[model samples]
Target chain A: MSQAVADRQETEERQTVGGRFARLMDMGDGALAFWLLLPTAVLLLAIIVYPVCRLIYTSFLSLSLTSGLPASFAGLQNYRDMFADPVFWSSFWNTVIITVVTVPGALVVGMALALIANIPFRQRWAFRLALLVPWALPLAFCGLIFAWFFQSDYGIVNDVLRRLGLPTVIWFNSYAWATVAICLTTIWKTSSFMALIILAGLQTIPRSLYEAAEIDGAGRVRQFFEITLPLLRPAIAVALIFRTITALQTFDIPYTMTRGGPGTSTVTLAMYIRQNTVDFLDLGYGSALAVAMFALSMIVTVFYLRMIRRGA
Target chain B: MKYGKTVLLALAGAVSMLPLQNASAETLHVFMHSYDMNLWQAVFDKYEASHKGIDIKVTVGGNTSEQQAQYLNTQMSAKDSTLDIINLDVVRPAQFAAAKWIMPLNDDLDGGTKYLDRYLSAYSKANVIDGEVAALPSRADAMMLFYRKDLLKKYDIDPPKTWSELSADAKKIQKQEGGDLQGLSFQGAAIEGAVCTFLLPYWSTGHTLVDKDGKLTFDMDAAVDSLKLWKGFVDDGVAPKNVAEIATDDTRQDFQRGAAIFAVEWPYAWNHFQNDADTAVKDKVGIVALPAVEGGKSATCLGGWQWGVSAYSNHKKDAVELTKYLASREVSKYIAIHGSLLPTFEDLYTDADVTKAVPWFADLLPVVQSAHARPVTPRYNEVSNAIRTTVNAVLAGQTSPEQGASQMQARLQRILR
Candidate 1:
């Protein structure tokens, strides 16, 4: 009976020590998590939340530099004026067109490039590196180069077309074509980013699945649809989200190449905001437009997440 | 021990604060747009040589007028005393003046009249907003026609003296000396350059985009006729369709590459055209005034910068002195030699050395003497942007001149009100 009691006491002591050690480990993990997250939280609040809140507050007020005072409360007048402004509507439509045209187009081209780069070829590495060149180049520089290439009088593209006995089309003068040209520039500049993302997803797919598909008599096209695409859902969602958000905010290319020109056909929402705030010195209206843009981007994010979840 | 530690910490804090305090003293800061930095550098060099005790620091702010205005507004709103002097564009003086972000030189300074007498009367008057000289004109520039003399000689045609005659001549040259060479080229880009260089002809033709009362006045028959003439140039293959998107640099390169017989450009291109290493048409180029418009006189659009002392600046007096010195004829002539800036001073325009150095200035001086400033208003930037947008719309055929003009008028009315 004495030996039995001693063994039970020893077992209880071991159990107590193990339980205390587990609690201490848990506390350490909690501390580590707090340390890791504090900087990010502070940074987000400083860089993002504060600026957004300030912008929102500014939007509700009539601010003028000449007045030399804090912006006066103007209620919803700025928002009301925005809706009634035709230029705003035109720019809104242009932003929509750019988003619609560039997002899906970039995704498809990017996926195609990712697939080609994934394949076993002699020049696969070279092709992959070359694909990144456009995205790596500065947007302004690319715009300048494209401007030269599209010159109606002496641009190389026109020269080549003329040599082939084709009618030279002015790329920027025609209202419809200028938008297309801008969209093309956006696609060329951003597709490599999508490809890089999709390529990473492609790498994550198991080799065994393709082997199994081949054993099941699945053709290359069938394999792609069955094995590759279904597995690439997460990547596609991420890429589409990224590309859509960026495409909606397309400014530098159109601003540099077209300046929303040929009658504001290429003026995106961001361009309109810049013009109102900077060119016209209408800060109240510009802030309202910025708020609208932020709201639209948020709505797009929510819609994308819902669609992504449903697809998954 | 605790007291000793506290003392060390306090000493460290004081050391750190010392640099900040010293940074606040002795330096006079100036802000200017990127393109004007060359002229500013020369002026600063001269000022530094003259003022031994004071230091001048300069910052190049932005590339576009809009960018510059926005940056200045933000800095001034923040009450940044470091921004001591600002270089504003001539068209934008009223906007800055209305805000009172800049000092009124006429009230604060002596010898203002003598300084004012050196500039062209129109330019000097344009800087006067609300009965104060808000800024002083530093440099002046205007657009002129640059033609390939050899090409004209080869085609056996005279340089065009009128828009109609120019159109005819352009077509004749295009037909006779056939290659990829266009008869004429100008900025058609949907930027301010297009409105300045391209639409000035239309305005010169007795068409005004905005009336003196600030109403949209772009839909007159003369304006439509002007648009049709521009379109005809494109249609007849005298001007390229892509000219609508050409930038200033792109247009310059096209002219340099011998792609066009005539180029409508600013005086900045004269040095490039004269330098044999930089241009193919070095000796073959000739400069002339823009052709007259039908039933109206030829008008050149004024392009230049003005110097203003910032209200936020603690060194306002020094800034004013610097501006006055920069605007003096001696400094203006030095700038003309070093930076190729067209002298804003009338005396410098007549200087024999300047005439010899930039012979084209002899032709451009008369043009500048009669150059037209864009409407002088506090909202000139907005007005100019609206004009550019409307003209671009008309040129692109997205909207008729009437519709665009009407829309612009409506927008301007709202802005004015």
Candidate 2:
């Protein structure tokens, strides 16, 4: 009977040991963290990383919706064709123009508005709210509004020009003019976003700096140049980066307005990619073009990150 | 085991009867490009009344063909079954049908159905891609040359039957009219409308993207001449340079305002030209088939919308029924008269009510009968884009006609390969 009792105790001891081992495993810090983050990690893998990697992989294949079979490896033929394509190069230049013009154009307007918002005046909040109206409107709606405002025949812009005894030029017929017009529209809409960011930066600057500068025989412009300008650099850099990216990926405004018209004078990389993939169904070539665009965007991002870091 | 089997049988029976019970609460959604919404509303009203307990909701998705196609792509590419019916542009059937994005209507159209024979040959052929009738035509339109009848009468000129004649007449009219009135206006914008505008000359000259031998047939001399002719409109001071930015509606506006003596447009502009409050030249507009070039024939590019059933629709039966109802002769006649659209039904052209109501149908019927469909390939959108870009280049003075033709041929070859 004593031996039987000992055996029962031994069995109980082994059971406790097993349970403790399992509990120890569960208590591991890395294991707990992994379990906690598994869902989000899986989600990112499925949606973002998977699609991106698959696109990169697809760039090396001869797959098309028309082929309807196992995809063949294409190597670098698509890239070769893309590099040699005149349309691609021309569109790239167009994208560069849109970006270069819109970025600084918006920045100047935004900086001016930000300074105005920083003014210690009555109804300052109302001014800020009003400034944000353009930014808050949907992009497509803004495009339509601008299209109506700039159309050649009945647009208000031409009407005003004619009424004011100025020459009425067709806004979207010529290549250079169409680009300039769309860039101006982009700047008009996006300037509000940049202003809001700069306004936030403006508020963070200490009042003491301006006051001290003013007391030291510095004019208002001098104070702005020294204190406000230097302090606002980081915010401007960040805003410029976002604005550049937005310009690089612009699709809706120009699409809705002119549809990359005047013989593809405004076809950006995104539109080109869409034309090849969605419109043309040339998946392989489109994926190659898409990867190239992603790489270009990455370069721009890296440059901006450095600029932001240096400014900060 | 017996109890479980009895419960299983009961569950199966209940599930089988669920549809019948829910039939009274059936609802359907139809997605289409926005045109005349009042006509569509009336058609839907009659349908809803005829079928008790079935409610239909109509959604106007997009305004232009490109926007509509893109919107549908966004919704349906992910196998979304939420949309039961889709109204497609005529050029969309080949692509959509080949992608299996739409359900084939062979079974529905077969079995002693006279519906297949009722539409014009071009209309019927447009819906059938790869031996499958995947959509039914709902509306029909054709590119037409609208000239000011009063201006022509004053100028003592018949409607110009050729491009050279039209150009010469336009010069004479512009010189005589001489007060903010230009010679001609045509859509040269870099959109789908531009493709249709370009195709009129290409087809009228007997050149096409694809020939009978399955050859890339874009390298014809007639095609090159057609491109040059379009550019000539600008160089010769006929169409204004700003026409390169004009869309269809803008062209119609200029013509209706009497700002131009001639306009190349579609039939949808007829009612507006005749009835708009601001119409300056009402009852004085006349249309003809788009003029041909020397040693070639005259033709018009067909433009219209079709109804396709979504392959993934859960309500296929209801969708098919609705499609048939929408394409019926009675309904087509009603739409043709009320919407100011050409009827897809063959007999509607002769229907006394329709003919009497429009009065222009008698003149328009011949043009509609000879309307040329765009390239019926699965890559139609891309092909059409190439055509538009090429023509736009010539018109925009970016490329010569010969260079544009070669570039078009090369681009089309690359895409088709």
Highest TM-score, which number? 2
Summarize candidate 2's per-residue lDDT along A1-312 as a digit string, tens digits: 699998997778658978667666768799888978999999999999999999999999987663334579999999988997767887888888889999999999999999899899999999988999999998888988998999888999999999999999777776776787788889999999999999999999999997888889999888889998888988888899889998888888888787787676678888899888876667898999899888889999999888767766
Query: For model 2, what is the error of residue B79's alpha carbon versus the real structure, in angstroms, after optimal superposition?
Result: 2.4
What digit string (tens of lDDT, one per residue) describes model 1 on residues A166-271? Answer: 9986787766877877778888888899999999999999999999989999999999999999999999999999888887787888888877878676788999
- Each model's DockQ score: 0.33, 0.33
Q: Which candidate should be chosen as best, given lDDT against the real structure?
A: 2
Q: Can you write out model 1's per-residue Cα lDDT over B95-164, one digit (the tens) per residue?
A: 8887778888986656654447667887787787766888988789888888999988987888888877
- Per-residue lDDT over B1-417 for candidate 2, one digit per residue giving the tens place of the 0 to 100 score: 999999999999999998778776577889986778888989999999998767888777779898788777667657788888899999988888877889988887654224567788778878877677889988888888999999999979999999889999999988887776778898787778888777777887777768744457774676687788889889888988876767888898888888998898888898998888999988899988888887788988888889999998888998899998998888888987886799887778888999888987877788888888777777777788888887786788767889888777777786676
On a 0 to 1 DockQ scale, where is model 2?
A: 0.33
- For all candidates, what are the clash counts? 1, 0
